[model samples]
Target chain A: MKKSDVIRAVFHSLLQEAPNKVWQPQHEKGLGFAPTNIALCKYWGKRDIELNLPMTSSLSIALPDKGALTSVSLHDQSYDRIILNDQEVVRDSAFAVRTSQFLDLFRPQKTGYLQIDIKMNIPVAAGLASSACGFASLVSALNDLFDWKLKKQSLSILARLGSGSAARSFWNGFVEWYAGVRPDGMDSFGEPLAFEWPELCVGILTMSEVEKPISSREAMQRTVNSSLLYGSWPKKVAQDLAILKQAMQVTNFPLLGGTAESNALTMHATMLSSWPPVCYFMPETIAAMHKIWKSRKEGLELYFTQDAGPNLKLLFLEQDKEQVQQLFPSVDIVKVFE
Target chain B: MKKSDVIRAVFHSLLQEAPNKVWQPQHEKGLGFAPTNIALCKYWGKRDIELNLPMTSSLSIALPDKGALTSVSLHDQSYDRIILNDQEVVRDSAFAVRTSQFLDLFRPQKTGYLQIDIKMNIPVAAGLASSACGFASLVSALNDLFDWKLKKQSLSILARLGSGSAARSFWNGFVEWYAGVRPDGMDSFGEPLAFEWPELCVGILTMSEVEKPISSREAMQRTVNSSLLYGSWPKKVAQDLAILKQAMQVTNFPLLGGTAESNALTMHATMLSSWPPVCYFMPETIAAMHKIWKSRKEGLELYFTQDAGPNLKLLFLEQDKEQVQQLFPSVDIVKVFE
Candidate 1:
């Protein structure tokens, strides 16, 4: 059968169950999986909210097959319901409200109510970009169910409206988010890099499984609004992003590791400069960083990056993964991307 | 006796023991005590090395009677000797070398050697600006012994040659260090505030009594050379200083405290952005900050500022001192400043 005929047949089946003016399927479902991306060059602040535009361009490596799996199914309920990890999410909760709002972006005007079930293997709110994976997977699944026929780039644009970092999750391997010029953000989307470093390994030093006190969105807004050192962040990120991209293209491990670590520190610097200062480094985090530095001095070839929370993500080559694992015995080894 | 006549007589008496260099003086002595100043608006990075000029203007409150006391006496020996806290400081030590270099700035073409003794009650190198008080006290004592007839501004300038923060220590109450445009840096010195907030109270949260791993000088140099966020710091500091001065003039505790805390955080942010990132906040330092924040949220008017080390200096009203002291059981109530 032709691809168009397959899509038409699926839609015809989806419309069979309705008894009213518009028929709807009781159980038409689509599912998708997407992984979170660890930003080597951080995206800290925004230029516009309506278009979800970033103030700085960023580079990240996608962690495939170790993120969120989301399923969307048409239901008989009058309102949409969200179930997270086998539990019904409270409708008035911030997480539920945010997830519902994100889904509304894809809801067609005359569509029937749908139920979303998100199963996250990655811990949410642990500075691991679980939201990014969750939203990306949800968008992907909804697109598949409705036969939206949206291209990857268009999917990325839609995902960014849910979360800025979610846009980068649509791609595989290394991805770059362009800090586009248009006010409408028509040009802003993630693009996979031309080259890939297959030997790269990542070790996630998860400090806590609990949710962070301050959300990344709130932290970014605070830094943008009040941090004294925030003025030059965009230009600094741009410079680092250029250097990082070149290093990645050439597979320069030292350059890539150093640039990513430095860029992460620079991002934290803006948070530290915010009024009442947002400090995320716990004692364990500092100790972890010290161990990484010590290992590097002893020729282990390892570097680390931190996001808005206390957890750390260390990057190294496949040859040095064992050594990195030994040095941080407390941390979990994330093997999906490796 | 007349002041000039008294100075001459003192110098004449010093000539009794000195057989060379035209027999200047033998027993002339002077003593001074000066407390360190905590920069409410931090002075980081430098504009000039030779003259010790600051990159940006800063404000501070001198903590009188809570620092170092030094005595300088003319001696018959051919060389000068320094004894700190009753122990002879080694000539090759950084402190000794820096002190000698500072004294050389005061030496005329031909002058007799002197014996100096310094007693410091405050902990050294723990981010309490011990050097500032030590150098300021030494300079003040030397000025009196030699009858230099220097004004407070001139004394501040001389003291700044030893330590940048030392210039602010020369004044009682509040002080400001001007980041001068002059190449010679003659105009860059500390000036006392015309108005004073006598009812203010301070609590020093001393996390460690030991010396810090990295000195402020080395940390500042690292930040200036490598920190990506440091590019726009001077301008930000200048803007904050203006607001701080206005707040001081009005005796507005909220403005003064808030600005001080924000400025200190901004200063540390630059350090955290350095290539290796000179982060000084221990877990206790963060805890102290949180306590202050919590108290503030509970309706207490309190704020905090930190210098180059782990300690936190809290600013509050006299009425709030007891309550503030109760919150942080480990903190020291600095009665001298209050």
Candidate 2:
């Protein structure tokens, strides 16, 4: 089925009405913001590619202020205009093309064109999940522009039509994205957990701010298609998800950190096993990892998780923030709970 | 059954006589040498750790002259004396302890004590399979010392009592070690393949010579016990073994190199999925891998395989020796088929 049919089915299920009927403009312009998230239990494989349905559930923590801010307004042109970081994106670029395609899902009948401006606090395409928060904030802006008054869960499903991880960017704390069984993904949405640890912190170690050679979407597809170890990934995610939740519930930092680190390594392990081998680690990435391991061995409570790109996200408690920062002077620390 | 009992049973079955009955000293001194081997299809998990029986069959190519040589002689001392590279090893060291334990299975009543001197061309404990060649040479020396005319298969089985990979080090060229289904491991031994590729070359890229923090024995045990991805390792080995043999049969260098590289990476992937994560890659190792991959993309036929340490062995052909040497200046090249 087409992505638009799935979107209409989702809107029909959630609002009991057509999207055009509820897409009435309430204002000339709308603004929205969303926090980026890092998955403690990673989302590595897909069950439905077109609908962005994951093969297993995942858990993530949102960075409080490191995300995307999007502003949207009705435009007179036939095609949508897109701007990123105050730079106009060319019409035929991959980014602009993808943004326009996602906008196609929510175009109002009376107003077909939109001007979208996005400002991301983190590096784009550098494993920072910039697309996630960008898509999520864009969905939020669309919701506000049409005065839909939808809940976070419904907005999450809409954002997921653009990117899978975008489903979990709607919340500012711990969030869990359910990998629903339905093919149309009517039930797959992010849910915010009530448990909160005010002392949790995430440190970003930016080895490279340049774009990754291989996108996470392509990497995930390659891993699932070729990696023999990919068969065990769902089981790994399930176990880590449980441990992550239990650790968060009791404020057990070590258990949480260790599991998150292992989960990320396992995801990369699958990628490494793929044919023509997808290795995202640079020389500096390996050096940083060895440094972290050595410091952790020497009685430092430091743990790290890596995404599809070469950068790392250090997971430590607020109590060790000073020590961690001292050890990694260039780290950009984010107060995850704050 | 005890290891000693298993050893005795194997001797009885092979010789149709007890070990001591055939342990007559034909000469006062005996000398033997063996070549070290690099696996194209790696041996990772073990089905029977006590017997050193692998979970699946593996294929390897031996590096001529880069191996171990040992001399053994009857001694008057009450205890065995072991010397490595002209230096006497302390009796309590791990190497001495393991050697003595394996010796306990082959002690003769007429010669209660012996002195052994070993010389290895390759660096010890540097993922170069020094232990494999060492044990194989020791077993061969014992065979000559006792005047026991055992076949290569029997010697392979005896060497495996010390290290699993030793079973494949008895031959000079390509050897396949069968993972026999017997509990006593009677059928598990190396069989030399007749296919000879005179142009095949192996280049040693030594990133580290120090002993690994975790031995391959302990690493294999931990991965088999804890790594969820290890469940698929046997299947990977089976497929790679078939492909390696086919590649050899047709003299397909690219197929052989690609399959071998993928096999090695899959083994490391399982280790990464284990708890506490057994990572063998140093920063330099990662840098070398990226260099090889980039060169391959730019029309080089170079590939590499890593063992349980940070060192890598580059797989290429004699035709590209100068080019490969120019790309990797410090690489030590060996003509495998010579």
Number of the top TM-score candidate: 2
Backbone clash pairs for candidate 1 read A18-A24, B14-B25, B14-B26, B15-B24, B15-B25
Chain B alone vs. reference chain B, TM-score for every model: 0.89, 0.97
lDDT of 1: 0.79
Q: After aligning candidate 1 to the native by TM-score, how far in Å is the CA of A6 from where it should be?
A: 31
Model 1, runs deviating above 4 Å: A1-27, A294-300, A335-338, B1-27, B75-79, B108-112, B336-338
Displacement of the residue B43 alpha carbon in candidate 1, Å: 0.4
Off by over 4 Å in 2: A1-3, A15-18, A21-24, A108-111, B17-23, B108-111
The two-chain DockQ for each candidate, comma-separated, is 0.50, 0.81
lDDT of each: 0.79, 0.90
- CAPRI quality band, candidate 1: medium
| Tens digit of per-residue lDDT, candidate 1, span A1-338 | 54333333433333344313232332378787888899999989999764568998888988776789999888877667989899998889988888766654434454567788999988888899988898899878877776665677777777887889988998778898887886556678899887768788788888777788889998999999988788989878878888987897687999999889989988888887887678777767776777777678788889989998889999888897777767787766654344
